[model samples]
Target: MKALLSSRPVLWFLFLFNLVVAAVAPFAVDGTQGLVTAAGMGAVSLGAGAGLLRGHGQGA
Candidate 1:
């Protein structure tokens, strides 16, 4: 779990995925759909960050 979380490629993939989602979100939909898109992206970003932070603490 720690190794996976600390992996650079995994982190980059998540970052890129979030970027793509965020970039497409505004133009791909509207109203509730837009809100949902934003929320989903936010959740992914938050989860990745939280996991990395937790893993970093454990590693030290």
Candidate 2:
């Protein structure tokens, strides 16, 4: 588990894939619900994932 998480290539793949999820999230549901889902859930997860990927690079 840690091995894959610490791998640069795997991290990059996950980061990019998360962006796809964020893009589609805005249309996964109806009306304001979908927008909320995208901004709240999707964006939060994206921020955390980005931090994880970048943290490793900056030696955090």
Question: Of the candidates shown, which would achieve the greatest TM-score relative to the real structure?
Answer: 1
Q: Model 2, range 1-60, lDDT digits (tens) per residue?
A: 987675666666666676676678777887887777667756655765776756665642
What TM-score do all the candidates reach, one by one?
Answer: 0.59, 0.52
Candidate 2, which ten residues in sequence have the lowest lDDT sum?
51-60
Question: Top lDDT: which candidate number?
Answer: 1
Model 1 agreement with the true structure over 1-60: per-residue lDDT tens digits: 977866756765776688678668868888888778877886787677666666675534
Q: Candidate 2: list runs displaced more than 4 Å.
A: 31-60
Pairs of colliding residues, candidate 2: none
User: Candidate 1 at 50: error in angstroms?
Assistant: 0.5
- Alpha-carbon deviation at 36 in model 1, angstroms: 0.5
Instruction: Provide the lDDT at 48 for model 2.
Output: 53
Off by over 4 Å in 1: 1-8, 58-60
Count of backbone collisions within predicted model 1:
0
